[model samples]
Target: MAKTLLIGANSTIAQALQENSDREFICLARSEGNLNLDGDLSELDDVTDINGLVYFPGTINLKPFTMLKEDDFLNDFKVNVLGAAKVVKKVINQLKESEGASVVFISSVAANIGLPFHASIGASKSALEGMARSLAAEYTNAKVCFNVVAPSLTDTSLSTNLLKTDRLVEASKERNPMKEIGDPQKVAKTIDFLLDAHKNWMTGQVIHVDGGMNNLK
Candidate 1:
């Protein structure tokens, strides 16, 4: 079985991957005392020859543009963008060692759509997508695929506040063309497909797994 590294492993989508994926996983997250994206990555230096890397660390800083302080932007960038960058850089060589290695980053529909009060998260996710595309371009020749999964309003612990009330959830569902919030398992399945060793041909793409939120509506 292929070995995979899952950052922010406690996240709902990462948990979905754990429950559903066949690949061997090395989970890293603060809850397990395994990772701090801002801290040293020396702990993972010995984790090598990884076939896949899925970065799940992200921020949902959805505050009004005027309410967003510079630190809010910096913090969002650190979590959503720089954290993935750090982990990817740390294991770039390990991923290259394996055949058809894949790297998956979780993005957001806000990265493409102009959603109000999503300034911080939107900006950071957009940067994350750009970085993924550039890295994909750099590694396509090496057979190391990098791709992104952008979802919108998923029903996860991370989205608790947003979907607190039935009315809020329904409102969210109504806004999307599919009349539903994103499912973590469904999103995980998309990531699984991208991580498939046999499906590494596609690169430099942002796969929207949002319930038609990125386009139709």
Candidate 2:
């Protein structure tokens, strides 16, 4: 069986996936794999086939729309959208050749629901969700599934700035309908479910692992 490929593998959710899943993964992150997200895709050329690919690279650029500049939007897209595109392109052949292949992209709840200071990330994540749907449609015949997992604020290192103080943590939780934040392990389980091609029939779908933040009032 072809192993799953995990980009930006050092992320908290990515780490959770690594620990909780029984399947093996090929982890390639900026820090560990010497990955140059903007550079070339030659590094993964050695892999013969890829059954699963999950993009964990993302940005947390929380700033008011007025404060966000063009560069900020471009940078967020570079990480959240373009980088995933590049990685998928590089492994396109392998993913197509492999049976029951799947691709998963990480998104944010802010992409669906409006949130203050989330313009940049929201835009990029929304683009990612759109791109994932498009890719799913493109590869439907190829048997290569594509899906997205969007989550709300989670207690991760990437979100330390937002959840630094107890007040901030409580405030963030209060905004969610569940009155709680996200859990990396739980989100990882959702990703793992998508990775299972035999059990999963869903595609072009954005599974909101958020605390009912996308729909609830």
Candidate 3:
């Protein structure tokens, strides 16, 4: 049985991954969970041989680039980029222990496609994508693969603000070429695949789980 670790366990996407996964998952988060990476990760000391790591911690800071202050970009980078880097660094040794370990970072379609008021998030996620690709290159021989999953607007707690009203939801649907918002389960399934041992050959890739928003639009 491969051991998997999930950060931001309380997140809807993480919960979806847990519900759909058969492998035992050690969940960690701030305050309400097993561990908080914001402070210390000593909780991971006892855990070993981590075969997979999925980082679900992220933020959505939507504001026009002109209105965004320096702190806005910094805050988004802290959550989306720095946090994932820290978690991955902490578990890297354990990942190296597995025959074929995998790391999946949750990103956004905004990283690849331009959208108004998405500057902070897009910049941070783009950094994350670059970091993941570099790490994948460095760890390829060690069998520790890194990849990203970029999803469009999904009906999750994190996205409640975007889908608060029927009009907002309908507008989002119309914008997507698929005419639908992505489901958490659909994105979770893709993450599950990236973490599978059989997916050793598939690394350093960005999988767009959007509703045809990244390309079709």
Candidate 4:
């Protein structure tokens, strides 16, 4: 049984992944969850030979660049980048022990596509993309693959503010070429595919599950 570690296990996407996934998952989250990476991951002391890891924690701070403060960027980076970094660092050795380990970091389409009021989140996710690519290169001989899944405004709790009103939802849908927001299940499936042993040949790539929002007009 391949073991997988999931940070922010309470997230909607993580929940969806849990429901559909067959592999064993060591769920971690803050407060009352299995483990809290914000403090220490000693709970992972017994965990060895990790086959996959997925970081699901993220922030949605959509505001004009001028209106954003330094703390906003710092907070976004803490959750989106630093948090993932901490978990990955804690389990890198365990991941390397597996036959074909895989790491998937969840990012946003805003990282690649320029969108209004996405300065902080975009910057943070962009850093994540760069870090994942570099890690893929560094771990090329470890038989471990690193990749990113960039999703557009999925209907998750983190995006409730953006899709709160019917008017806002309709406007967002119109902006996407697919005429719809991303589904958590669909995005989870993409993550699962990348984590599967069959995808050993793919790495250092950003797979967009973003309803045609990244490339389409």
Candidate 1 TM-score to native: 0.97
Q: What is the C-alpha lDDT of each candidate?
A: 0.89, 0.90, 0.88, 0.88
Give one digit per residue, the lDDT tens place, for model 3 in 87-111.
8878898899887899999999999
- What clash pairs does model 4 have? none
- Whole-model alpha-carbon lDDT for candidate 2: 0.90
How many clashing pairs in candidate 1? 0
- Between candidates 1 and 4, name the one with more favorable TM-score: 1
Residue-by-residue lDDT tens digits, candidate 4, 116-157:
999999999999999999988988788788999999999999
TM-score of 4: 0.95
The window of 10 residues in a row where model 1 has the poorest summed lDDT is 196-205
TM-score list, all predictions? 0.97, 0.97, 0.96, 0.95
Please identify model 3 stretches exceeding 4 Å from their true place.
Answer: 31-33, 197-200
Clashing pairs in 3: none
Cα error, candidate 2, residue 142 (Å): 0.4
Candidate 1 stretches greater than 4 Å from native: 197-200
> Candidate 4, which segments miss by more than 4 Å at Cα?
197-199
Record all residue pairs in model 1 with backbone atoms less than 3 Å apart, i.e. clashing. none
**Worst lDDT window (10 residues) for model 4?**
30-39
